[model samples]
Target chain A: MLTIENLYVSINGTPLLEGINLSIGDGETVILFGPNGSGKTTLLYTIMGIGGYEVTEGRILFNDEDITHIPAYERSRKGIGMSMQRPPSIHGLKTRGLVEMCAGKRTVDVEALAKKVNLESFLDRDINLGFSGGEIKRSEILQLMAQRPKLLLFDEPESGVDVENMALVGNMARELLEGPSEPDAQHTLHDLMHERKTSGLIITHTGHILDYITADRGHVLYSGHLCCADNPKRILDHLKKYGYKECIRCLS
Target chain B: MKVDLSKYEFTGHASEKVDDLTRLDKGEKESMKMAGFDASEKNRSASFVQIDHNHAFCKSYDPGVEILPLGLALKIHEGWGDLKWKLLKPEKDEFTRLAADSTHGGYVIRVKKGAKLTAPIQSCLMMHTNKVGQNVHNIILVEEGAEAHILSGCTTTLADQTAAHIGISEFYVEKNASLTFTMIHNWGENVEVRPRSAGQVETGGIFLSNYVSLKPVKNLQMYPAITLKGAGSIARFNSVIVSTENTFMDVGNRVILDAADTRTEIISHAIASGGHIIARGHIQANCSPAKGHLECQGLLLNNGIIQAIPELDGRMEGVELSHEAAVGKIAKEELEYLMIRGMDEEEASSAIVRGFLNIDIMGLPPELKTEIDKAITESEKSMF
Candidate 1:
């Protein structure tokens, strides 16, 4: 479970996210719908404890504990993982090496993970260096799958991903939410699928994510304010029909 | 049939021909003599061989080898005579000044064409007095398709004294030949070293020189050049200099590409602590389709100074030239990360420094690489 009470974030003394309040229950997926510059990234970075974003006046509670000042790596070690929108290219650090590092296990079967994510050919290459857009996205997913965090944050995962790999990524996302059913099997196809206790908060602007997985609830974030929380299909259809103009008008 | 110049102001009168006939003036007769052909004694052609006053104590470990001081005739008669050494001096005016005051120990080494010499040609110059001076000349002529590896080292044993060591080494890599020249210098704290070395490579030849300095002297000024004159020739220069304790080092390396499809590469590394180092590297591609590359990197440990200047000059439009120079201290994150991984601060720092220096040494021969690694490790232990 995650909770934020009156979160305020600013960059260079300019307010980006003002008086934001939200919460997510256990095993629940929350979709954050907002237009450009609506503090979506700032909010995600604030929750993930990145970007050096100062929490002017707010408290972030994770699993009923105050973790507002936790560092990124510590937060990651505490069952919190984030898939960045644009990951940094780390030279000489192989993808498998990073997976093993983040997994914190020397005996991790990296070859299997690579094969699962279709990155088996590039396992020995540098981490995300010269990888295509889709390959980078898949690498992010592979890292998340290895981390197996309790609360996952996806920052625009749909951006720049081609249609051919979108289904595989979408299915992987679905499988990560469900628990692994058969643990004794050699290949853990259902391992990520059976892990049902994991929750996620996805940020999307195009609303094309509605075709992939079932979002439990949707919240419209406009002008640094959470206007309303409703059904995912209803909100996505409303945004598709009227855009953010109507949402801003409703806020006024 | 020659006209006299009565109105001209001659700086110095031309001397008579002495025991050395290899120092003929720039003319057809000199060319013929350089090609090992006998000249007509009837014409009485004049030769200018200006021998210096400083005597070179000559001795050879092998009985078949001959070591001469600074005479060109003894050098030629002993089968060490090749025309390449004559062209290494500066112009006439500059050559005279250097020759008159230069203390040169001239050694001629001749490996027959296709002959392989396993033993390195070793030489040493001892500056035993304060304000001592040394100018050593070494000529190594590897005939066509021959191969050899020469190891030359210079050092000073005494302390609290000022000394100068100027060595001029000329190497001729003939057609289809290969040569590796490794020069290591560990001068004392008060010695000043000015080494001007040059080498010329003929067609299908390879010349590689690796220069490394561990200790810091008072001053070091070196400009070593290699000219690739024949097509498909290659020249490579790898140099590393470390200075500390108020030392000043000025090092330069240049490679000239004169024939088509020639290739040249130069890599320099400088590490300074409580001193200053100036490294200049240049690669000039004058012929079409030639390739030139230059890389110079410096690491400053303490408040000492480092100046890296790398230049690439291309005259032909079809040539490729690239140059890169970086000067900075060790990265803090990398240092901290290495420290956290069970290495002490000194160990971590030395590891970082060794990594920086051994980057180019990675692709060297295994034996040479092991020697370099051992040398750096010993130096690092001594520094700590």
Candidate 2:
């Protein structure tokens, strides 16, 4: 669903991401683990086509179409959506109205959807204004659900959320990637596979998200390089024991 | 600032009286309706209509409220002298001087003591003749334990006809009384306006003022102040002004928290599209346990300019006063946030501007609310 070849990103002539090649197949969800200032966010933003992240030398393809030169808004129109970690607060723009806009041509029952996230009372309020950490995450998930994009990018969904909110956000994130389903018993890693589903690229630092949902693969971004395409649990276990330096020294 | 007193003819514009406002012609009625005056007087307890320098219509439908012309009220009520030009002195400026000397027709609206009139009283000051200078004095009194609302609309008869309006209004909120005054200005592009207004609130009284001006005007300058003189009194001011192309506006508000436990607040939103606007607010807390807050925000859509001045003055150590002022274009982050939601740049900017102008006031009539929404929509069309 997504492809990148030799992605070289720079900000005002300062090199940020260099010589990066990554691909996520249809119905595949890739987990990216990176330390602070490891170009993880730069990679996601470059994929989303945000300003200030100039692509000096690279080509980004989604569904076999080159979208490297498209604007951020055009990328959104082309079924690419992002859940930013720290979204800006837009005063006077109600959250419900934005959710409806995110739906596009699709009709959405906003009140019913807001009830799923316990945001029924916050529909009329300005989006992201004075929202708590958990509320912000849930609001982001709610927007993505309404948008129903084919390719979803999650940037640190576990940050700033408590355990209770984490459970809710994780389940919601799962439902967004895989189509919605009725309440059922917990699924093991064996039941995580699907023939065709929404594609996702999630950025994580703690890897606590691995306990909630299944990931196709886990890769570490170190010094602007992708390394160690292995099982999600094995990579997390190795990072917990040996840290990222071992992966950089051997896995690359 | 360059208004010539001799250029406008103050006399010979005395309009004939009309007992029923519905009898007026279609054009005049439409213009007045745009200024928030309902010719049929629907949802209004009382009304006063003044054309040029004449009192065309004045009446009261509710027994609890009294509607009288300023000239007649002064002749009958001897105590009018004490209330006239009491809060704002006539020697302060040329506009006040003209209003005091040539005092034409204005309204004297008074709510009886202990009376609570749920419906608002309406007043329309119209410039029907060419280059007419309308100088008027208005007084509003909400007696003890009374609650009242007054909606005043000021406008010119035609879009391009030149006119000038110099008005002096004094308000008094008695003990335990509540008064909400809403003013809407739909002036012409060639009109100049100078309004001198001041109010005083007594013990346990509440005074809320809302001013909205959406139409174009050549020049406008006003700074209305309200003083909380007694303990437990509260005052709030909300204003939304748009300076369209070729217009210049210098508007502000001042609130004084004088006694212990008194509170006051001022909030204003100004938009400049190919025009200039200077938005100012000042809050002064004099006594201990007093609180005052002021917020002024301005949005510049084009090459137009905006200047926001918010001042805070604390007379004593125990008083709390704060202010916030911001003047700039829209934030890029906010725009991108909307764009990601499938809105283009133009649609996103329009939504932001509309929201910026949507200020919530206490007692806004439905008609006025619709007018404001229409005004915002109309202005946004020209902006993009």
The CAPRI category of model 2 is medium
Per-model TM-score (chain A alone)? 0.92, 0.93
After best superposition, candidate 1 residue B203: deviation in angstroms?
A: 4.2
Instruction: Give the Å error, residue A125, model 2.
Output: 1.1
lDDT of 1 by residue, B1-384 (tens): 111222221222222323333343334233222211222322221111122223323333333233444465354575455443564664433322453354344455555688655544443344444555555566677779877665555645455656666667788889988887767676678776767677889999999888777776888777778899999999988887778867899897989999998998898878887678888988888998899888888878777689887888899899999988878887654443333222345755775677566534423334445655666776675445
Backbone clash pairs for candidate 2 read: none
Instruction: Give the alpha carbon lDDT tens digit for every residue of B287-371 in model 2.
Output: 9899998888888877879988878989988988888887888888878777776778887898788777775444577776787
Best by the lDDT measure:
2
TM-score of chain A, predicted model 1, versus the true chain A, to 2 decimals: 0.92
Weakest 10 consecutive residues of candidate 1 chain B by summed lDDT: B42-51
DockQ for every prediction shown: 0.04, 0.60
> Which candidate leads the pack in TM-score?
2
Tell me how far the alpha carbon of residue B208 in candidate 1 is from the true structure, in angstroms, after superposition. 6.5
- TM-score for candidate 2, please give it: 0.95
